[model samples]
Target: MKLDVELPNPQNLTEEFEWTFPVGTVNENGDAVITSTDKSPAKVKFKDVIGSQRVTLKTKLGGRTLQESVFNVQVAYNKEVKTVYFAAKGGNIMAVKVDKNKTPEMTIKPYDMGVKSGQHPFNIFFNDSSLYVLDCGRQFTYINDETTQNMGDGKISVISYDGKKVETMLTNVGGYAFYDPFYGYLNAAEKKLYFSDRVSGFAAISLDARNQTMSRSNFPYFVQSNRLGYYGKTMMYTSLNSAFEFVDGTWWWAKINSPTGVFRFTNADILSKEATAADPEPAAGVVFKNLVIKSFVVDVNAALVHVVENSSNALYSVPLDDTILKAIAKVDDIKTYKIADLPIKAEGTSAEPVSITQLILDKETGYVYFGLCSDDETLYKSGLYQYDPVTKTLTPIVEGMGVYGVAINNAKSKLF
Candidate 1:
């Protein structure tokens, strides 16, 4: 079908037209398709793209869009859009459809999105219909080997909302990706991404540019082990399993081997000092100790931090307030969910172990989603599940699949 829009006023009869539509609404070949000025009445011949797509038509003069020309057009489709995306083996990103009225369905064989070889697409973030994937490439394959060439070959890539465009923002990226994707965290407030890399203890990537050209040189180190005010000065490098930056600008992190607690630090207290070796940060402190947090997400509204404890292999809600956390609240008092009752192997397999990664929050619904790897069955079967913290209800969505990374498209605070 062709969508045509005639010039309303027709002031400049010879003026050209620019067409802007949803990612899928105007795809041409394969995936790289957007923006066109080819037809007379600002016409667009739709292809496989079908949906209630919002189409915008702009009239151009002198090769530029007219003052304020914007149009709205909606095309209906057969099914609701996809909501859940995860990376399985082979570096392919698959999609799972979760509609209110329909049964959950997932793509088979070939995936919806593709990434480069040797990548473990662990974390996927959705903002403004785009996905930011953190691929811990070769980080695990050569684990424990300091001389491995590709040990620091991880990367970060961005994909179009429709899974058409895949672009890598950086390479040679290293992270503490053991079995889960909690190797890094994104802070929408500051428009920056913080992740633990092998090269730097903790590096921050600024998302100001459409595409960043940050090499190991432009390393935005957040909390270097050697930085003046940093706490863990004795360690040469860090293997961060869980990390988060609160809206208040406080940084929180927990290492892979650390069963003590989550460490906390402020930017001003750590960055002001020059980075050296074996020098501890005087201001560094542990917010909450004795809880080995494997993977976690913050529920700002509830003021709780839901974490998957490594030792117990259970889900628990802890007070989000750092002030109260430091006051020595007993870990047993907080509520614990039932989903983590299974044996999730966050370790290597006999020859190669499976990583039971994924703990995310759908803020809009106040529900938390997570993944479990098991050979057993239950009301909440293996795969991925959605938990409602309010009513303590657990609904299993995707079952029987080895889920590597799970990212929901429920990002209310989008930076893009």
Candidate 2:
């Protein structure tokens, strides 16, 4: 879009001009060619358009929008918005533009899913243009007794990337809750959704599209029955904090907190016989003990898991050997890096790290992303950031607000 206006007084050009876009379209920061003189027109890059549309331009006073003068123009699409979505404080889900090389980005409230935000969107994972959010809602104060049937509002929900559709999928969250499900992962290969609970290692949800009997409240799930068998028809306790896929029916779990470490198990052994966390010979679960990890993501091809320790300044790693990945009954692999040593840049000042809340990875690019919380505004600003494992580089993509979980959405069609 180009603009040219006549000005009787050169001083009139000192006032700010604001552009009002049409409805159903989104505008990001620009690639506009600006000039002080009125003789030449200014070119402004625009946003999402289906085919062609009309727009308007307006004037501003001290950051306030004045009366708008309507105008019509044919517009086209801006197709290259690689978006980053975050589960923020106060149940807000945020979307913003980003790039691969750690480019600084900006976002506004309008970028959210056009629907009411979740209560405490603890963590999120994106797939096929939909965001799977694990919210710890109800102020994190609501605790259901052991006899309860539902996990309530503080569970999983799905939201489309463009905010066109939403579904709350927490109807049959498997009985009681010693605590809420804090983090989760979607297993597309197995057609299941798994989440980590404080008391019961974790729980599962079936996303099998072929099942006609599946409903909102009667979904079949299994928690650890005893220490050995995991296919318990009802609820039992498992003390794993988080779970991630290793390969096929095999999985890796982090400790819930007592004796910290990771656990590995396969479905063949879990359902084949009874098992317990303390079993020595015929156990369904295997432990790689002693390291405390709250959340982690597995790199299937690399044979490694990127781990985040609770309240620590470092990021640790656990490697797997192909020969004994699922074959071994016990395991041990630990590597650490001081991830907090990298300062977060804000307003031209470098801020020190305060705390890390969540962690996720982009499988397509192999880039890691996480949410950081800041207590002091001047020292640091909370927002989304990315870490390049290959380059050992950290970049603050966007800052100024606290976020709980973050996910990457490559198909950001709303702004295209």
Candidate 3:
């Protein structure tokens, strides 16, 4: 099937296009706009709807009936996979498998983790043995173990597998204080669990593999940073104002110009003593640059990174050397996309608390998925997506999940 891929305009902040698909095909039209308060899904219209925001096609991939699809899309992957997992809207875990040609087949595990509200899955962590899922605001539970635990204040649970049940370990970092904005921003990486408190700065909890106890370390001055990934012995992250590289030796910082701008910082002047490194030259002397960071991981496998400013989704890539210390060049793709144009809401709904703002990549599959809402238009009720790089395509593999949370897991294969 032929798909029309519309790229967004960086400058205008709004771009629209029109393309015709084959007969008997239907695309999500930008023309019909509705609000949650609307009475009916069929009615409602917008004047200057550019074009259909999503690409739709007729496929026998995993559809039981014309409208009933077995494959519920949560995210897309650039690389091919034998099987993929998504948290379903109806509180189940879906496994999507397709042959070489992308013909989807499916099976679902209806093990409930007590997620009653929200639009997206609480959070799913794939480990060596089983899938560890956190039902946001509900309870943290695992499929294999059938054990559920309540998250204590200032603590988030991390699951580790031991060939049997998924073990739940708690980190001592404060949750409400770290993620004041979005509750789902808690994630695990490089043996460290990172999270931000609502009123406080960022915190990293080191997971001791030997004893399995989580150690807490407060990030001196940084607050509300986005997880960029781990490189070497350091952890990378971004905030609205700046980017940071944290290592045991020192804390490095860089002023961030945009949200989607790929950044590399040389803490050529990072000093632990100073309150703000950007402050004037000290009376005694100068500070030594402590950290030299190269590339930040928006998508670890694909090496995709960006620092977006405003809602103007202008994507940029910072090509870096092996050390991620210097940027070779900042490359911009000819194509662009407006986050507003993406078809995120269900068939008829208004924008709500659950809307997608960030994209995360599955290192195992090279798929780029965004944090979405229960409804596409709502930013608060969040879910996840997997985007295919080859097709330049976006598909919703999971839905009815909750708001912005950190999702990081690398596994050998699906448990089922």
TM-scores of the candidates in the order shown: 0.64, 0.65, 0.43
Task: Please identify which of the two predictions, 2 or 3, would achieve the higher lDDT against the true structure.
Answer: 2
Candidate 3 structure quality by residue, lDDT tens digits, 272-350: 4423323443221211112111112344345544322222222223222233423222222212421233433432122
Please write out the lDDT profile of model 2 over residues 1-416, one tens digit for every residue: 55665434444434455454444443235433222223333455443323223445565545565676655443322446466778766546766665553223422222544455566565777777677777655534324454653554366777877667777666324434434556677776766777655444456676533222223235433434344343231113434454344544566665534445456666544443355444443243444444445567777655655666553435654454544334323222333333443222222111111135467777677777777665555644677777776676777766766677777876645352
Worst 10 residues of 3 by lDDT: 286-295
- Cα lDDT tens digits, model 1, 1-416, are 36565556545546677766555443333443367676443334444333224556677665666765554333333454446666654535655544444433321112344443235665666666666777666444326644443335567777776666877666553423332122567666667767665323667776544455444467656666555344444223433444454445566665444234566667665655665555454455664466556567778888877776665657766667667666533356343433345566555522233344556787776777776765456534556677777776667766665566677776321111
Record all residue pairs in model 1 with backbone atoms less than 3 Å apart, i.e. clashing: 51-75, 52-75, 229-281, 230-281, 260-290, 348-353, 349-352, 349-353
Best of the two (2, 3) by TM-score: 2
Model 2 earns a TM-score of: 0.65
Q: How displaced is residue 297 in candidate 3, in Å?
A: 4.6
Please state the error at residue 99 of candidate 2 in Å.
Answer: 1.5
